[model samples]
Every structure is written in C-alpha cells, then in structure tokens.
Target: MKNENRRTFVKKAGIGIVASLSLSDIPAVMTGSVPDRPEKQEVFFTTGFKAAEVTTDSVILWTRLCGQEKPNPVVHRRREAIFRHPIDFDEEMPVGSMDGGVKGIGGSVKVQLSGGGQILESEWHSADTENDFTVRIPFDRLKPATSYRVTWTAKLPGSDALHTAAGTFRTAPQFSSPDAVRLVTSTCQYFWSYDHDERGFRIYDSMRRLNPDFFVHTGDYVYYDKPGPLGTTIEKARHQWHAMDGWPSLVDFYKGVPVYMTKDDHDLLRDDVHPFSPAYGQLTFGDGLKLWRENAPIAGKPYRTFRWGRHLQIWLMEGREYRSSNQDKDSASKTIWGEEQKKWLLETVAGSDATFRLLFSPTPVVGPDRDRKTDNHANKAFETEGNWLREYLSAQENMFVVNGDRHWQYVSVDKKTGLTEFGSGPVSDAHAQGWDQEDVRPEHKFLRVKGGFLEIAVVPSDRSAAVIKFIHRDVDGNPVHEEAFSSS
Candidate 1:
C-alpha cells in the first residue's frame, strides 16, 4: 500500500496496531527524513481575551480559539456530544452551549502579580468545542486592591506548537476602604466592519490611557441587526463574535482592561425586541440571548451587582430579559424589569449602605428617545413602573442612573423625583445618529452629541462625605464636560 494509505490505516488502528506493524509493512516514505504524516498546524485565539466579574479576591478570564480552516471531525463530534448533554449552573438551564465544527484546544494559564511574582498556575484546561472553544479561567484567593497579569498558552490538537495571549486586571478594593474607585462607562458601539471607518476604533486607545479599574459597556457592544439579519444559529452568532474580535483595537483594549457588558435591542435581534417578538428569518430572542451569554464573560444571568470599597455600588440591570412586548398595552401591570428583578432592585437598594449607588441600564430610564415613543422607561409604555422607580429613587440619597442605547450624551434629572441620570454616549462616531445636538430638558445639566465615554471618580472627603466627579471625555480622552456631586 502507498504511504498515505498506510498512515490512514495506522491512524484508524490503535497504537497497539502501530507497535505490531513490521518495518516492511510500513512504506519506505515513513523511514525517510521527511515523515509521510502531515503535521496539524497550531490554532490561535480569534478574539475574547478579557477579564470580567472581578472582585476583591477573584476574577474570571475569558478567551476563544480559532483557526484558519474548519475544525477537525473529532472536535465536531465531541462538541455535539456536549450539546446533547448540556451542563447546568446551580440547577439553572444552560445559558450557553457550543455547536459543532469548532476546534477544542488544550491550554494552561499562569497568573502573576503586576510586579512579576507568579501567583497561580492552572493545570491543563481544554478550550473545549462544547463552549465554542471558549475558556474561562477563574483566579481566586487574590489580594484586594491589587493588579495581576494573566497569560495563556494553547496547544493545537496533534501539534506541539502553541499560541498565547496575555491580559491584566485590578481587583476591587476592600469593603469600606478609603481607596478611590475609578470607572469608565460607554455604550452603542456599532462596528459592523473593521475597516469601515478611517480612525479604526481609536477610542479604545484613549480609554486604555485613562486606565479605569473596569469598563462598563452598557449595551450594543455588537450590532447584530445592522449589516444584515441577525444570526440564528450558534455557528453564525459565533462567527459574528469572531469577526468583531478580529479588530485590533478591541483586542488590545480587552487585553489591558477588564469589561462589564450588557446587551441591548440591537445586540438581540431588532429594535425593542422582547421574548415574544416575531422571529426575523430564523432568528429568535432566545438565540440572541444564548449568543450574548456565550460570548460575554458572565456565567449565567447578566443582571448582577458590583461593589467597590464603601464609596461605589454598581447595579447592572438586565433590561431585555423578561421584558414585555413593546406592543403590549401601556398599563400599570405592564413591566420592563419583570417582577423578580424589580423586587431584587428595590430590596438591594433598601439594604445597601454604599455612599454612591449607580443603576446601570441598557436603555435610558430618563429619556424621550428623540421624541420617539419607544419602550424605554421615559416612554408611556412603562410609565407606571417608571414612576414607581423614580419615586423610590427620589427618596434615596446619592443614587444615580447611568444608561446607554441613545447615541447622544446628556445628564437629566427626573422632573418629579429629582433623580439624576447620566447618559454614556456612543463609542463610535458613525453611530452617533439622531439628536445632532443635546436637547434642552427641564433637568438637563450637560449635553454633548459627540461620541465619548463617561468617567466616574469616587474620592474620600473630609468628615464622612465622599465626592463623586462625572466627566465626559471625547474619543481622544480630552474632557469635554464635567459634573460633580457630594455624597454623605
């Protein structure tokens, strides 16, 4: 038989068969300097490479594997098996699952202190095809108010060559500590193509200079609606994610700083999509939700809270899941946050002792949406719940709402409740559509329609009070507007 046929037979037969084969049975090519077998090339990471869910002592590292060609058949078969028998998190249905045809790569992660001391090294962890060849490495028992560097090396199947990536993150400060908390927030990043614009995502470069503890991507991180119909299948959605990750700017940004992300209507399927929205082509809300969870650094549900020292408490709300249809009747019973999340929000607010409480919403809770009647809290669709929330927030001191979805930036206070709300403008200048200029509102303090981000600084003051400074910076990191308030 030819050398190719012999090698194929050898691969199919067990290693025992290979040992039993005679030298004569093996073709002459096997004995030559150039082996008859072809070597599998190493696969590298397409994107991801981010840190999330960072706490005083723990942070989750995320990454995805990619290759030049389709994955090996073995990888697809194994991934299908995992899909059939999905694993749940704490008895909840699996929020994410990998589809077939994605390669699974084995890897190890090494974490070290910023100054170069090794802290933790993980054993071999497979970036299994089951999770779309994505891996989350959790580093625990870390010190508070500390920075760590994480590095990963991945080995391709049947190959000795390795691929690698590295990132850094700083853990949250200890509870009630006097350490200042710095955070940056932005939304509406609609980069359909990497080279669509000339600047090529320069905003991220500016953001890296600011060196905030973490970034809050309120929503529209990926625009699934534009450029075409939303992806319906796992593979398609995963492809979109890989394409977005291919961007050099995003890759560099996530590698340096951790991010907290939430999804909006565009990221899901269409504008104002709910659980019951009519399917576009084969795409459904459930598919979008799965893709969002799978690609994000989060493990289960997106709604969660983060506390930084005693000065800052962040409530990241899930405005999409469990929301009523936008076409639903605008009655008192109509809901956006649903009952469970609303209850949790109220209870969490009532019990929190932090000096500054920030409610991060995917959509503006205090907005008119450029005179459009939409499903946001400012619209009549959710007036009843909106009023209740405004009233509840009115009674609470040192509370603010920071929102995305609207491309423009503005700081507005609730007319009745006096609750202040800050809007983080779009990250892409091209997506800064509608509201060419900030509209004059009864509570409007600052308005800028240009693309920029919002930065919040919480610093200790004399006595028991803390000063919170809100500054909006242009895409190049120059401060365009600023607002300040005191919290006691």
Candidate 2:
C-alpha cells in the first residue's frame, strides 16, 4: 500500500484500541513481526508529539494517541471538578491537579545518549484520558549540556500493531559552567482554515537550521477564540491543539530542539482578556486554563525561573493569572503578577548572580500602544507597578526584557533608565488588527512588521561581563538585523 493509504488503514483499524493494549506487545508491533500475521504492517503515530520544560538534568517528552472513538471519561470528570471548584477565582488555591481512575493508553519511552550510546528504557507510561491521551515522559538524572534521542512506542489495544515517534534535545549547562547558550523566541501564531498557505509555518524550518539550545514561545501558541469548524468546548480546544501538532514543520522543529512556553491573551481566550472578564463566547477561563495545562509538558509552577550556565538567568512570568480586572483603576492594588508572584520576581532578581538576567514578558513592558488599552504592562493602567519595576530594574547591574504579543518586531530602550527590550515579531505575516508600522515607538532601535524570530547568543567571558548578541532572522533564515550588548 502507498504511505497515505497505509496510514488510513492503520488509523481506521486502530480506533478505540489504545486503551486495551499491553506494554509487552509493543516491541513486536513496532518491528512489524507480530505473531501469526500474514504480512508486515506498522502502526502510525498520532499528530501530538513534542518536547518541553528542558533543564540541565532533565527534559519532558510528550505525545498523544489518535483515532479514539470518544472523549475519555476522565476528561468529563475533570471538567466537572473544575466547575464544582473554580480554582481560578479561588485565591486560596491558585492551581489544581487533576486526578481520577486509571483510564490510560499504555505506552513505553526509550531515551538514548547521543555520544555514549547508553539506552534508558522506561516502563509503560499511560496516555491519560484526562489529558486527551497526551503522555509526558520525563528523563531525569541526565548529564548537563548533553544531547539525547527520545523514542516513544504504543500498541493498538486490541491488535498487535504499534505507533512510534522520535525526537532530540540538549540539556542546559550547569549553573557554574561557562558554556554559551543560544535561544530563539517568537509568538502570535494564528491558524485559520481559510488561510491555507504553507509558507505561514516555514519559519520553523529556518529555526531548526540555527540549532538553538531551546525556543521560547512567548504566547498565542493557539487562538482559542478564532472561528473554526471545530465546535466550541474543551474538546474543540483539544482538537485545535492536535491540529497544530500535526503540522509537518512544527513537528520537525520540536523534534530537533526543546521548547519553553508561556500563555498569552489569544492562547487563553479572546484578545485583551482580563482576570474576571466574562467567558469568550462559550469558552470559560477555567476550561481554557485546563486545556492549556493538558496540552503542554509543564513540570511545576507556570511562572518560574531557569538558570543557564554562569551567564544567563531567564525569568518566565505568568501574565494572565492573578491579574486584576481590566476595569480596575491604575493603583498599587491593581496588580498583574499578583502579590506572591510579584514578591518572587523581586527576590529572584535581587539574589541572582548571573551576568545577565533576562525577563520574559508575554506582552510588551515598554510601549506606544496603538490602542489605548491597559491590558499589557506598558499601559498607564499598570503605571504604579510598572514604575516600581522600572526603578528596581534600573538599580540592578545587568537586566533586559524580551516580550511578545505585538505582531511587529522592535528593539526599544527606556530613555531615562537605559533598560533595553526586544520584541519578537509574529509567526505569521499578518499584522495585528488596527495596528501598523507607523505605530512603532520613537525609541525603537529596529522595527519590522513581518514574520521573523529572535536568536540570542549568550557568550560567557573570563571577565565579569558577558557578551549577548541578538540576531533578528527572517522566515528564510537570513539575518535582517543584528545588535550586541554587554552585561556586567
């Protein structure tokens, strides 16, 4: 059979079989040597395979099982649990864990060291029903600054057929190591059925060629409110995620390198969403958060920090959660990071010893908003808190901000404080609605309203100062602009 026909046959034959399969039956199914089979046949993997939350000693591997007959019962139970206990509104419990009976699609994960050829095979790790058959397999006790290959296998529940996926990733160097770290950052990916151009996601191919240590997806990973044939519900959200995962370029990019993701307004709901805002059409904040958590391989608290060698320390902040209502007045009480997260941010910056502290903001922190909206930290609505943060950062030795959400790319510097910020352009060529190149601020060192990504190279130095180079590359991997800064 042809490739597409074979995939169709395997998908049709594999429906509703993931739950009944045993781990022991996967090896034969993978090798196409199942006992009593007339001819060799292989199982096909689902579209949802990627890696995330990589660290010096660990990395999270993920994949989803496709061709399910119906939604998993655990998903319904988890939805019911969210409805019963709306944790997003509850201040006491900022986050909640989903747990229930064992409704898992059995699978196995194998990790291999690239150079040493040491193979670490894991026992079956279930694709949980609550997570839409998505499984996250973590590889721990790994060496720092090393490369590894990860492979996942699963058998069709009733049949002796298996599906497989493979990916690669490199861990961060130790905190004291002087190794350099390369990172790519971008955001604002809006996929609509009407927009069928293949070039929309071609940037991933260029990103893979650069071979960055990791990619930081600032937000808009998916537009939950965009009109699609998929119905409005949590299931629709899962379908959207699966659709994005199925893209060939995206799959290839993730397989080459790991990603660090943060959620933005579009990814959560409609644009400019606030904490207490009403639901966007039929999707509630609770369901949106649940779907976001279920799809990604996040390990701990969403807002956390990562230390890359002795030169770079990255702070990934949560912009949506704990934010005050958009209708609130601009005061000290009107917060974005909430009290606890704000405290942590200040403490982490004060205590950090790295050469450069890079803060990742989902939205721009310094701006000339085309619209007079205060949803982002740049607006006057956050003046009080923003001023405090600016003063604190200015007092520090070496600090910078990297932001997304704006469809245009620009490098802006605060005139008074001398703090620099880099904005990663949109993933698609489309500009933000009601905004254009004319709206870019006067302080912008560079601005472009096209599709591109930011590549930052952190080079450690024998002296106290470290050199950081920012190369802005277009979709085809050509450097359109470049800038360098030193951190002491």
Candidate 3:
C-alpha cells in the first residue's frame, strides 16, 4: 500500500463523489437554511463559519455576509481550453462582472461563545460593503486545550433573513503540558479540478474524518493565475476565494476544525511572485495582499509559530512577501525568507525546548524537485541561502520539515545533510502531476505522483520522549504509507 498503486485504486473507483461520499451522507447542518435539492437547486449560502489561528487562550472566528447563497455557477465551454490551464474558456470571454462571483452584503452579525463555565457574548459587529461584508470577532483569555462552541447570527440591513450557524474548535495546550496533538496538512488546490461538482474537493471530507486538533493549509488555496476564468482583476481574485471556500466540503469541514493558513505564489498574484512582481492584469501585489487579509482570519504578522504542548512546536514560514526575485543571482544574500523572518526562525529554533520541532513551509526546503523549478529553497534559484538553512536545520537534534508547493507527494532525506522532508502533495487526483512515478530518486524513501495529504500525530511515550508518526492518506482516507520517529 505504500506506493503509487493506492492512487490507481482511487482513480478506478472514487472518481465520482457519488461513489465515495454520497450527498445523503451530509445532514443539513445549518439551522433554518433551506436544504440543497437534487435539482442542483439554488440555496442561500450561509457562507458558514471557520475557526482560525487558535492559541492557548484565543481564536479568531470569521464569516462573510454574502449577497447570494453561493458563487454564481461557472461557465464552462469544452472547445476553448487552448492555454495550459485547468478550466476551459470561450474566445470571447466575459470579464466585466465575475464568473463564479459571490459578493459581500452590508450587514451586522452577533456572536456568542459557550464552552467554559462562563458564557461570553459580543455586541453586533458591522460587516459593511467596504470590508467585503466579512466579520471577525476575537475571543481571548479562555482556558487552554479546551473545546469551545461558537454561535453566530447574521442579518442583512433591512431583511428579516437571519442566518444562524454554529461551529466548534479547541485551543492549543499550554507550552509545558504533556498533550498529544494530531493534525492534517494539504496544499495546491485548483478550482477546475474539483472531484465533486457539489463538494468541491473530496480530500476535505477525508481530512474532516481524521478529526485532528487543527488543520494546516500550506498554500495555493486559490490560483490567481490559473483559469476557471483567469483572476486578472481584484474582483476576479475575490471571486476565486469565495468560489473555492464556499464549497460544501470546505464550508462544512471548517465548521468544527480550526485552521492555520499560509500564502504561496498563487495565493498572492501569480506563479513565482515576489515583492517586485508585476501585477496580474489590473490586480497589483498590494491589492492581492489586501484581499487576502480581508478573507483570511490571520491579521498580524504573517509568519509565526505555535506550540501544542511540551512534545511539539511548529514554525509556519512565509515565503512570498519578502523574497529576492527568482531571477536574482544565487548568492548568500539571496533569500526565500527575508532577513528578519530568517533571524526569527533561527532564534525560535534555538530557544525551543520541545521534544520535536516541525517547520512547515509553503515551498520545499529539501526537495528533489524538477530542475526547471526556480521559486523554492530546494531549487538552484536560491541555492546559497537554501544550503545555509538546510545545514542549520540538520544541526537540530529532532527537527523535520513539512512542505506544500509540490504537486506530487514524497519523503526525501537530504543526502548531504540527512535532513528529512514530507511533501503533502496536491488536494485532488486530477490536480496531481509534475513528477514521473518511475523516476524515483536515490534520496526518496517514498514517492507518489498522485493527490493525497499528510497526517502527523504526536504522542507522549514517556516522561521524557514522544513518538511522532506521519501517515500519508489517499483521498478516500486510506493510509497508503506510514513513517514514525522517536525523540532523541
């Protein structure tokens, strides 16, 4: 099972959502919301709710007040997919309004928290048209490692339509506590390659079943450059987020699980984008940044770390905002992580006393990637800084890397430094590619050119050691590969 055959099985059977998870499997979770009929009937999108950036005592809750129930249906034409893109298009494409567009409405929302002994409530928060009809209410100073349920009600300005939804999440444990943590990580999601027309991506349903403590989306959540109609304008870019995040699979999974999100090339503007990168049509880099902040729950510094007890600490790296151009000469000064963030990473790694440290980067740091790739630390594009980072990481006693940009899943140990990395692969089978299944490298312990995700579990084995296990699961939630490491 620890090979490419597992994917071949998925392709043969679970190619359709009806075969994997039938629509009847989902109970209508949102109260007072109309059920989506089999006619592919138009139901009002509650836009649901998601938990993000959970800390020991705080979590940010986010939701959008959409004017419509869901994104406008996509327009697909079979004859005009001329570009090397995922979706088909017509010669005379409509670009004025958006294709899969769902606009934010002017409204206010009320939220209540009931988990600990004390029930907390909030005053009505305005979600105006200026902020994209989104509202974020933060609850702080709660108990650590505790489960909390959040209930919110959204009301449009004059309409009696009140949308009520509830979701639950657990905060991280205290740094010194001996708590075990389980989480799933995935990346590289393309809109047109959705396995189910209604569910969006089948993998979301799979990951939801694991019932992890949290989820990490390494990046490429939306393709600002790829088609489903290209996202060349700010309106189109905003359309990409709602269209992808508004899916039933995604909307439902985020209901119970909190998530940590990172941005990669596609998340920003286009492929290989840096600070000096040009605009994608009328969408400038700054505009992209603003839109991301509006949609995402993370507000402060983009790069940060979180600890899930004495056993595990994870550093999530930011690769886009402050990197030298990919075309720059490879030198010590060239960097994928800017000097400030790199310094912070080094200091945090050295100061942490956790049993295991996991570095999650949006791009690969120890990759056996294709030679043509130039945007990651594993490429010749930034080899000098990459080598320094690798050597430094190798010096750590119990450290591992989990990265997301690559389409294929693999586990590779750096031959020169003995550092190990796990690539989480793409979000679906149709979206997986970019590597040859037969061309396994000498450094690879496992390699699969198919879509899946990586799940890691941290458990206390004794007072002083912990067991960290990595399971690579296919889209149907079947484990294809498993690897384990023990604290030194």
Candidate 4:
C-alpha cells in the first residue's frame, strides 16, 4: 500500500532521483504549478502535422494546409472561473479566418521516408475544398525494428516555394522477439484549461522525456461539447481540433513519437452519445464520427490489437462506434461492445500467447467510478456485461486494463474477480476533479486526484517470462507511485 521508487531505478542504481527535485523549486498557485521541464524546441507545422496509427510495417502520415504559420487560439469573451462546460460561439468570434481559427488552404504535399539507409519519396497529392485540405498517406511494407524519418514538402495553391516539415518514429520489433518496450497513455484534456499558456499542457513535456516507443491517447483528444465555444457545427468542431492540436507542446511531442488514437464520449460528441442518443445542439453523432476520422491519422477500424516483440500485447478498444444505447435495459442483449467487437476482443486475446496483455479503454472497466456516472463498462448501468468482462479477463494470465475519462488517477483491483485497472487522470493538474481524496473506495489500491499520466513498461525478465511495470507520475514527471508484476 506504500509508494515505491521506479522499479527500473532500484534495479539499475542503489539510489535514484526522487521526483527529479524538491517541491521548493516549484512555484505555488491556487491548484499548484507546472514545474520547469527540460526545454524541447517546438517544431512548427501549421495545420495537420503528426504521425499516428503506427505499426510494424505501416504508419498513417497526416497533415493539413493551414493558412497561418502558428496555431490560432480560440478567442473567448467570457471567463469560465468555476466549472468547465460547453457553450456556443459569440457573433464576434471569427469562425473562418486564421486570426480567430485555422483556415485551410488548398495545397499539394509530397512525403518522403528515410532511415536505416532507405529513403522513399511519394508523388504529390493535392488537397481540395472537399476534404478541408487535409491529406493522409499510408506507408507500408516497412522494415521492422528500424528508425525512420518522414519529411513532407507542401506547395500552396499559388505560391511557388514549398514549405517542409518532418517527424521521427521507430517501427515495432518482430512479434516473436523478446524485446522490451515502453508506452505512455493519457486523456481528458480541455483546451481552455491548459496549465501553461505558452507550453500548453506540461504532461506532454514530461512524456517526451521518457522517450516511449509509442503513445496511446485513450480519448478526449478534444472536447467537442466543452468550451472555447461548443463545437455545434463542422466549422466550430474543426476549430476545436485545431486549437487543441495547435499547442506547441502537443505538436512537438507527436513529432517525435507516433501514437495510437482512440475516441471516447467527449471527443466523440457530448457525454455518452450512443446509437440512439440525441445530438449535442445541431452536431449529430455521425458528424462527431467524421470529425474524429478527419482529425486522426488513422487506418482501418479504431479498435485493434498490436504486439510489441514477444512479451507485450496491447489492445486499443473502440467504445463508441458499435455500442448499444445507454438507455437500453441491462440484459444479455444490451452491450457496450457490440457483438462483432466483443467477438474480436475475445478471439484475439484467447489466440495471443504474449506474456503480458493490456487493454487500453477510453473508460474504466474495473472502476470505483463516481456512482452517478454510468457510461462505461465499470458502471452499474452495464453491470451485467461488466461482471462478465471482469470474470473473463481475470481468468487470463497477465491481463490488465488502462482506462481514461475519469479526471482522477487511481489503481483498482476488483476483489471478487481479481482483475485490475489503472486510470490515467486528466492531462493537466487544472483538469483534475470528480472524486474527493477522502472518498477512497474499497477497490482502490492507490488514489490521487490530480492531472498526470501513466507509464507502462514491459521489461524482459531473467527468471520470469516478463515484468510489467506501471508507474504513475505527477504533471512534472515525478514518480508518485509504482507497481510491478512478474509473469511466470
């Protein structure tokens, strides 16, 4: 029940740095303060400049043609001093210009991949008014366990000169190799509530230092329903995506490490929008789906599993796409993961022989979530399937869940089923809320209601099959708690 130093530190050195430094070095605010992170130069790309859906031999390279050089801010006239909520835009809020929001310019881009003595360049692809000047190029048949740099050169409609931007990533090792890997997972970021104004969210800086092989966004990439103007239309929704992704910290982080992006309710539309749920103002559930797909550099379906070498097998779940209505009766027929997705999950997990298997869910699975919340597998609204999922997963060897949506950090072990879940709290300390520190439940093994992220590392063991470590850190990259499980 006590906090432990990072397991790697104890293994490598007799004594290691605790939280990097003392609290005296940090400035105090009403909620606390963002510590000084090691300075990483921000790489500027005006519009869609990130790589995602990374795999062994393929990656989705995404970019958009923005008219401006930097990310445009969301101009607001009111102060949200208390709770964060969604609201429509004012008449003065410019919806079509870069000064108020990102405006797309039709252009053509050529992408090139370089690394390990191999360089391949693609033909120029034109962006048009139809798709908002965003383009996605999927590169495949790549070499495994190799580093690659992707560079894109863009030519504006009338401009003769071409502008260029680049990003770096490493492919996953062969599935059968016993190679260790590390990844970071985070969620629940509000654009209006970023911790550092210039740096955006400090968690991105903290995560960049770890140099994880990959990043998993469990969802809520942007709040379509939360303020800086509620995303009630395509224009406002695009503004939400641009303003969030436009942050220097976020853009810089994605430029270095590739990510696996998933969608939850907030980013999807309003809270818990299902097949039958009503729209948020004029924004339909279908529009929400298109917005996510438009912004993300995704390939194939949202829910899929990936293997890192021989030891780690990670499953990224899609909660919203194929789900039953929340108002439905909690019977066998009423399901969170529709039949097809449920079948895929069971079949894939049972078929995989990896030493450690983890599922990245946008919402809690084995949670002590707030009683009033009933949107995820952890709630009583879905208790029938929740119990079944817990029992089924608990019986599997070296199985665990990492979830998002909750604004607090926690580690919970289901007493009856023995299944465990880790909650990666909000992306900023300012975004943390929901449960009280004194409201510790029976299932909670460790609880901290603050903004931060969870780090998962699969380190190969000499005596065991593999050792999976979950380390929780504050916004400043200081380890608050750590746990390790050695697989046989």
Candidate 1 local lDDT, 435-475, one digit each (tens): 74735666788877778888999888843579999998878
lDDT of 4 by residue, 247-313 (tens): 8888889888888888898888888888677888788888888888888778777888988888988
| Per-residue alpha-carbon lDDT of candidate 3 for residues 1-488, written as tens digits (9 for 90 to 100) | 95699888787775564456666664456234576674322213356678899999988888887767766665563322222244346423544344556666677788888886858888889987677777788889889988988888877666676778788999899988888899999999977777776787899999999999999999999998886666788777777787787778998999898999999989889998999998898899999898888877986889989888999999999999999999989998898899999899989988999999999999999999889999998999999998998999999988999999898889999999999999998998877888899998988999998899999999897767899999999887899888999895
Error at 435, model 1, angstroms: 1.6
Best candidate according to lDDT? 3
Against the true structure, candidate 1 reaches a TM-score of 0.81
TM-score of 4: 0.87
Ranking by lDDT: 3, 4, 1, 2
In candidate 4, which residue pairs get closer than 3 Å at backbone N, Cα or C atoms, i.e. clash?
Answer: 48-63, 48-64
| TM-score-superior candidate, 1 or 2 | 1
Candidate 2 lDDT over residue span 212-294, tens digit each: 99999999887766533122566556655755665567767888888888998877866778778788657888878888887
Candidate 3: where is the Cα deviation over 4 Å? 1-45, 74-100, 158-161
Candidate closer to the true structure by lDDT (higher is better), 1 or 2: 1
Q: Higher-lDDT candidate among 3 and 4? A: 3
**lDDT of candidate 3 at residue 482, scale 0 to 100:** 89
Q: Using lDDT as the measure, name the better of candidate 1 and candidate 4.
A: 4
Question: Candidates' TM-scores?
Answer: 0.81, 0.80, 0.87, 0.87
Q: Report, for all candidates in order, the number of backbone clashes.
A: 0, 2, 1, 2
Provide the global lDDT of candidate 4 against the true structure. 0.82
